[model samples]
Structure formats: structure tokens, C-alpha cells
Target: MDETENGNLSSDYIAWTIVANVLAKQMNMAGPSAAYNGQAPLSEAQMKRIHDYFFGRLHGGFQIAELAATLGMSRTSFFKRFGRTARVTPNQYLQILRVEKAKILLRNENLTLIEIAFACGYADQSHLARFFKRYVRMSPGRYRSKMREEDVA
Candidate 1:
């Protein structure tokens, strides 16, 4: 609910989508004939390529069509496959990546939230906070504080 209210899901999920599944495998659970495995969303190699590209361009936002072209996939194919594999839209995946990046960046006491936001490709600090809270369930500042406390402990 919060994700939809905030207009997004967490970026951490994106960082971990982490698979390729078997297509020909038979399911023996339902009398051995209920169904066969569905095709995997993308190959491990393809996911790695997408992750690399997204990481490389993290600081600069991108368009879905542009990303599709970069992957040599049609927009529809890319969207469908990514959605199937990651269980979230490409834009949502990007947001998860951004939030995860922000989490790491928050460890640095010197840089402000605004810097972290831009570093993670958000429009501003508030943008980072909104998504961060939605996905992480805490404000960035509080998260940073908690992390710092953990470090001290």
C-alpha cells in the first residue's frame, strides 16, 4: 500500500533479482502432467548485462526505450521479460537500485542526503527520501542514524 501510495517499490529487490530458470523441466507435483516450467524471464548472462548497464548509468537516468535498445531488445520484449523475471517494472527496478545505492552512501557521514540522492540518480533529496521510506520503511535520516548507531555499537 505504501509503495503504491508513494508511487513505487523498493530498489533492493532490483539489486537481488538475481535467475534463469529451466523451461523443459517437468513438474511432478501434480501427477506428473499438470504443467511444464514456464520460460525464464532472461538468461543469467542477460540479467548480468542489464545489471552492468544499469550500474554503469546509475548516475544518469535513462529511458526504458533507450535501455531496451542498449540491450538489443524491443521495448515490449524487454518490459515483459524484465517484469517476469524481476517481478517489477524496469523503472521500479531502477528505483530499487537507487535506494540500495543510497543505503550504502548513507554510511558516509560527510555527504548529505541531497548528495546521496543525486548520486543515486534521484531528482533530489526528497525524492530519495520518499522512495527510501516507502521501500525501506524509514526516512533516510533515521536510517543513517540507525546505521551509525550500529557502527558505534
Candidate 2:
């Protein structure tokens, strides 16, 4: 492998190691249960409004409090209501959406990571890589390479 590839391999290893260690410690600490407790179901109108808000503004800054206010609810209520209805936190949902868009853009092979990151509402390539790895379990560069290889095959 070339020097750049070697460096990236080591970097990836170190990053993932740090993440694993941190996650293990956090997992042991007492935290809110991930289970869905009984709550009032989101109304169809509420569901539609949220869906429209998210899909329409994937490239905009996402603030949970702002979204909660827009939905006419308090932050705490929005958190519980959204989690119960969407099966994920707002941050998680946003990352997944951005990463999914990035995946599509990666397939083009013409767009740089920076371009994709901006288009996907990330601050920079590093920010995009961080969330992409968290949600997709791989770097954007590696994912793009794999997809290209699969297309060729």
C-alpha cells in the first residue's frame, strides 16, 4: 500500500479503538432505557409535519428545540414524542438522512467529499466522515471505493 493508504489504515484503527472504548464505558453507566414506553401516538398530522420538515430541510441546520417549537411542543415532549413515533432521536434521524444522501452522491465519483459534505449539510469533510462512520460503520472514501468495485463486478 502507498503511504497515504497506510496512514489512513492506522488512523481508522485508532479512531475506531477510541470509539469502542468510549462506547463500552458509556454502556456500563446507567442511562435511559431504549425501550419504547407507552405514550400517546403521534397524530397523523403531526407525523406528516415532521416528515415534511425533515425531508424538506435536510441541508439546513437541525436544532431539536427549534423543531419542537415548530411542532408546537416543548423540547422534552418533542423528544419523547418524536422518539416514540420515529423510532429514533432527531440527531440520529438527521445523520442517517445526510449519510444516505452522501451515499448517493458518492456513487457519482465526480464529487469531492467536501462537495458532498456541504450538500449534505455537514460542516466539512471531517464532520461528514465522523457521522458517516458512526452510522454506516465505514468511512465515506472506503464506501465509495467498495460501491465502485461492486459496480465494476
Candidate 3:
């Protein structure tokens, strides 16, 4: 590895060690979840507006420009603020939300995989299956079968 990578590895190890020692001593000084320093994250109002817009138009194509417009923010500003607030890029958050909705619909047993895919905002069944496997560690079809088995038992 390069010098920078080695330095980062050591820094990460030191940080984790400090956290581990603190946890062992039952010190709750910083807690596990700490807010980052520097640029402000999105406010609650901004987050709520984003959530409302995203869910309301869940099955359609999204544009960062469109979202930025709704919040009166420039695209660059919106991207940075959203990353800070959500801990993921906007598109990543959208995919996760889509997969979650698909999971819920899968339990119904009435919706076919294609229906679930489109309903959850994926382009098609294969698209849903790809991300579903990535996030849930199984294909949607397999996940549905597992859910059905659990329902019976």
C-alpha cells in the first residue's frame, strides 16, 4: 500500500482502539453516534420536505435539479447537505427506499416480482433483483419464498 493508505490504516486502528478502551471502561463521553464537525447538515424541515417529495413520487424518475428547486437550493449545495444528513448520496437513499418498499410488497403474495419492481421504482424485475440481492443478501424471488414459508409456520 502507499504511504497515505498506510497512514490511514494506522489512524483508523488508533481511533478504533481508543473507542474500544473507552467502551471497556463504560465511558459514555462521546457515545457511539457523534455528529460530524464542519458544514451543517440538513435541517429537520429540509429533511421532511425531501422525504415527502421522494415518497410521493417514488415510482417515477427523479432529478437532483428538481429536488433542489423544491428546496430553493443549488444542485451542488443540495448534494453536499443531503450527503451529510443522510450519510449516503441521494440516489443511494432512493435505491434503499425502493428495495424496502419491494420487501413490504413481497409479503402480500399477490404482486408478481415485476409488479413489485415497478411499484418500488425499479426499471424492471432484474433491476430490483440486482439491488435486492446486494442489500438483502438474496434475490427477491428467494426472499419472497422465505417470507411465505415463515407465514405458513
Candidate 4:
């Protein structure tokens, strides 16, 4: 291979190797010694616990206060820690999660907007429409219509 081609191949191999290492570490398939040692160390176990707690339970009627208590932290402290770890406030994160689920329901077309709203944890269709507009920049109905048009195209 030419010098440029050889360099590109080497770079691609290095990138793939790093990705594989990270995946292995995340799955805990690699031995303890294979874990990443990086700057600004925090407990990976603690972070994993937090991630599971937030994502797994939050959608099923788990309240913020209860989450904070589960983490053995005051509500304020928990909010700060959750924000620091997640890079968004807890409520913002929950809203995003709920909205994403709502988008899936919108795609189904069989569910009424009110049903989808309730399924995704909103109080009603109006509440869903408000937050959906804020993040998605369109009403759910309009968004679904656009998706249908795109599918036909």
C-alpha cells in the first residue's frame, strides 16, 4: 500500500481496537485488570448502579424523591449528582426519555394521542402536545404526518 493508504488502514484498525476494548469493559467480560484506567477517576461500579437505577425504574412511576433516597443522598445532593453524571437535570432527562417513548407511539398510528400520552407518562394529550412541541418543534400529529409523507417518498 501507499503511505497514505497504509496510514488510513492503521488508523481504522486502532479505532476498532479501542471500540472493542470499551465494549468489553462495559460488559465486564474482560478481567478486572482489563478495565479502563483514566484521568478523573470515579467509581465505575457506582456509575453503573446509578445508570441502572435511573433508566430501569424511573419510567415506572418512580418519583425523584424516592430515587434520591435509594441513592442514599439528600434530594438536593442527588439532583446535583444526577445532573453532574447525566449532564442534564433529572427532570429534563426524564422528559427526554418520556418524549422518546411518545415518538414511538406516534409512529404506531393506531393509538389515540391521549392513549399515547398516558402511556408515556403525560397527564393527557394536551400535556404531551406542549412538551412535544417544545422539544420536537411540531405537534405530534404534524410530526406523524411528516413521517408518513417521507415513507411514501
Q: Model 4, 1-153: lDDT tens per residue?
A: 234744687777789999999998887864444113222222566567655665674346567788767756566666665665677776777777788888888888788999998888888899999999988999999998998888889
Model 1 / residue 20 / CA error / Å? 32
Misplaced by over 4 Å in model 4 are: 1-62
Q: Write the per-residue lDDT of candidate 2 for residues 57-81, one digit (tens) a residue.
A: 8878667888778877777888888
Poorest lDDT segment (10 consecutive residues) of candidate 2: 30-39
Q: What TM-scores do the predictions have?
A: 0.69, 0.64, 0.69, 0.59
Q: Which residue pairs does candidate 3 place in steric collision?
A: none
Better of 3 and 4 by lDDT: 3
For model 3, the local distance difference test gives: 0.84
Residues 1-153, candidate 1: write the lDDT tens digits: 246654355544443342112222333333342111323477788789888878877777767888778777777778877888889887787788889999999999999999999899888989899999989999999999999999999
Query: In model 2, how large is the Cα lDDT of residue 117?
Result: 98
Regions more than 4 Å wrong, model 1? 1-39
**Which of the numbered candidates is closest to the native, going by highest lDDT?**
3
Q: What is the C-alpha lDDT of each candidate?
A: 0.79, 0.84, 0.84, 0.73
Prediction RMSDs, each to the true structure = 21.5, 25.9, 17.7, 16.7
**What C-alpha lDDT, on a 0 to 100 scale, does residue 70 get in candidate 2?**
86
Residue pairs that clash (backbone atoms under 3 angstroms), model 4 = none
Estimate, for each residue in 1-153, the C-alpha lDDT of model 3 and write its tens digit.
234744777678788999999787785565443323325788899899998888877788689999988988788878888998899988788788888899999998889999999889888899999999988999998999999999999
Arranged by TM-score with the best first, the candidates are 1, 3, 2, 4
**TM-score result, candidate 3:** 0.69
